[model samples]
Target: MPRTTGIRALIRPLRQALRRRISRWITRCCGTPHPRTGPLPAPGRILVCQSNSRLGNTLLLIPLLQGLADRYPHARIDVVIKGCVHGSLLQSLPGIGHVHELPARGAAPRAMLKLIRELRRLHYDLAVEANSLSTTNRILLAGCGASHRLGFAGPDQCLRLTHAVALPSVASHSALQLLHLLTALPGRAPASQPTLAVYPDAPTRARAETRLRRALGSIPANRPVIGFFTRATGNKQLPNAWWQQWRAALHAGGDPPLLIEIVPPGGLPVHADQAAVSTTDLMELAALLARLDVFVSADCGPMHLAAAAGIPVVGLFRATPASRFAPLGNDCISLDEPLHPVVVARETVWRYDRRRDTRRSA
Candidate 1:
């Protein structure tokens, strides 16, 4: 067993070296340098590559998209993303012209070739790789044939980019890290606090309201509606018992707030008696989130969605740092340490009450 372990350890560095060599070869073949000294030209066609499939990462790109729109109002901004759900969410964002969905890894080679052809046909003036240090994303950016390519100045991928921003030595929020790419563009202003903005259409809002009415009965005019998200992607999930305790405590105070469980399409239901709403559609989910007075969720994609819809969110974090991944906006509260269910319930209620008071004062 010791011999086998030693052999495996020796093989790991060899594999990494081989991969790095191949990446460098590909970049040298496909990438060309554009001048970095002069002021950046106003691009007519822009391609933003964020090939990560995780929903949270995709949602975080909203601020970068907004930044690009502000910098170049006339550019036709296109995005190359990994999932159809991400494409749908981005479609409604202002200044987005097209959303190109990349086939998942191990998909048919023909599909990848077809996507490459389509990207080349656009003849993009500029391409920005939003991921910090992804070899695959770097390769895609190299092959995109954009006149100017922007990305981070990492050891592996810096040579592939025409203009690369030096990555910060200290850790920062993912949204702030992505905004670093914008600094490479000449004449672009410094990015403000990152916040996602999504606009759901009227028809989608009507449908979402109908679904909510069916599940939770009539909408209360005066009572605060609190939305709870129980499931997260993996180990981030909280136990059902934890939620049950919180729900019970929340109701113990005066008149109970209307609790709506927001479940993802294939996620487990919070409780048999709880009013749960599940949907695969992004806009419908956004529409539902927009109406909620407060949203309580784990550090998950839907948590970002609720924040984007301008709802106050109470984000519970256990595995990840709330400092880095907490929902944007002043209305968000992030609890990183373990707190009692009663405490969580009270804090959520207090946030809603404060919001109400502020609105009244306004």
Candidate 2:
């Protein structure tokens, strides 16, 4: 019985993989093919497939949304994504007319079929596979049966794509790459710029302001408040001791800026300050981060979040390539490899000081 149980557990993953393969094959086989070779038709109802559920990916997706909206002022833009909560994450984001929640790969077939049915009911002028490498996104793009299909194509997806774009060999910002997809379309291309942004509604921003002031207590007008994110997923997280060293280095100058430790939902770790603020809401977190002078974190979603909030972000990259996932904007630092904690502290201080001086001069 024990051996049987163990084998069952081991084979569960294999079964799941087989299910996903079958599902992908089914998706690729579906859809009406209208292979266009020139400039795309002026789209009325468009679908964008970016099923990644992470905050960073959501933020990175904003530029493409903005560009699409700009290019087609009157087009109805619909986004197909993964999570139910993601609908709210994209709420009030300009240019997005609808958000479609799809079942993740290897999930129940019933839900997937229902989503596909709903999608087919609407006649889309275009469907886009936003991610260059997402086979699932390619499946959604092709299988959705739009007259035009666009994506950065590999060998598997190129034949299925109507507007197939070659994937860049060089590493570049994720946000920028998504924006580059617009260049593949017919007509004048949208200018490439960092458009990573999250809108905290007016009331939410006001509430966030009040909370931050209370948490911040009193400080001089010129003093910059530094927010430190101690947590990150995967191997990109900086150790608690490294944070300690970074903090010590910041204080070595005898003028320690106001440091606010940003805590996540679960619980605060040993390294976090006792008075640290915690919030699970992504937009609320962005609102809170907007109040900071400078935000620093490992190459995590919040680093991108802070950049989206229009603050100077110090993104410390340990495992991931900063070139690909680094925060995209002016005044953002993307430090890759062999990172010295003290050096990061110095750089953060320099950005804070530069901003303070600029504000004073203004």
Candidate 3:
């Protein structure tokens, strides 16, 4: 056993060294010239590389897109995304010219090659790598054939970018980090409040309304519709018991808001007592959230979606930091520390009532 352990330890260092050497070689071959200080040229075709498949990561690009639109009003912005669902979401937003969907999983060498050819043909004036410091994305930016490439400069990856900006010492919000990609450009104003915006078409909204009515009865105009998203991907999911307790507390409190549980497609069922509606389509989900008076969720994609829909959201953060991942907007409140179910219930009710009062006053 000791001999095996010693051999394993020796091999681990060897593997790391090999990885470092390969990384260095790739950087040397692909790295662009060091960044020059100057105002950006008028760009006609802009390519943004953000290939992460997670919904939150995709939604975070809204602010960056808005900023780019403001700075280069004439530029046709195209995005390279990983998942089709994210592409669909991006398609709904204004200012987006085209969405280039890359497969989130599995090998698609031919498809990728085709995509590269298409990108090269576009003759993009500027290519921005908006994801974290990733070598693969840097290589992809280099292949886009844009004379100007922008990205963050890590110790080993700075050479790959024509314009490399240093990341902030403290971790900033993901949206802010993405916006920083434009800092080197002249006359680029900072983006206004970073918020996700999803616009569902009439048919999609009608479908969502019909589904909600079928699942949770007709909505009463006077009653506040409260929506809850109890499931999240990975370890970010809250326990069923926790949700049950929260529901019970809400019911026990004074007149409870009309509760609707948003169950993601293929997600675990909510408690039988809670009204649940499940949908696979992101735009359909956004449509439903838009109709709600208040939405409560953990730090997840849907939480950001609800915020985008302009619904009041009480975002609960357990594993993730509230500062970096919390839903943004005036109507949103992020609670990071553990709180009693009754306290959460009370806060939910208060927020609902406050909005109600404001609407009446207005």
The model with the greatest lDDT is 1
lDDT of 1 by residue, 20-104 (tens): 7775665456532222334678999999999899888898999999898888899989999898877878888878999998888
Better of 1 and 2 by lDDT: 1
Q: Model 2's lDDT to the true fold?
A: 0.78
User: What local lDDT does model 1 show for residue 205?
Assistant: 95
TM-scores for every candidate against the unseen true structure: 0.90, 0.87, 0.90
Candidate 2 or 3, higher lDDT?
3
* Worst lDDT 10-window in candidate 1: 30-39
What tens-digit string does per-residue lDDT give for candidate 2 at 54-84?
A: 7678768888888888898889999988876
Total colliding residue pairs, candidate 2: 0
Ranking by TM-score: 1, 3, 2
Residue-level lDDT of model 3, residues 275-301, one tens digit each, is 788988889998998888889888999
What is candidate 2's CA lDDT for residue 194?
Answer: 64
Q: Which of 2 and 3 is ahead in TM-score?
A: 3
Candidate 2, clashing residue pairs? none
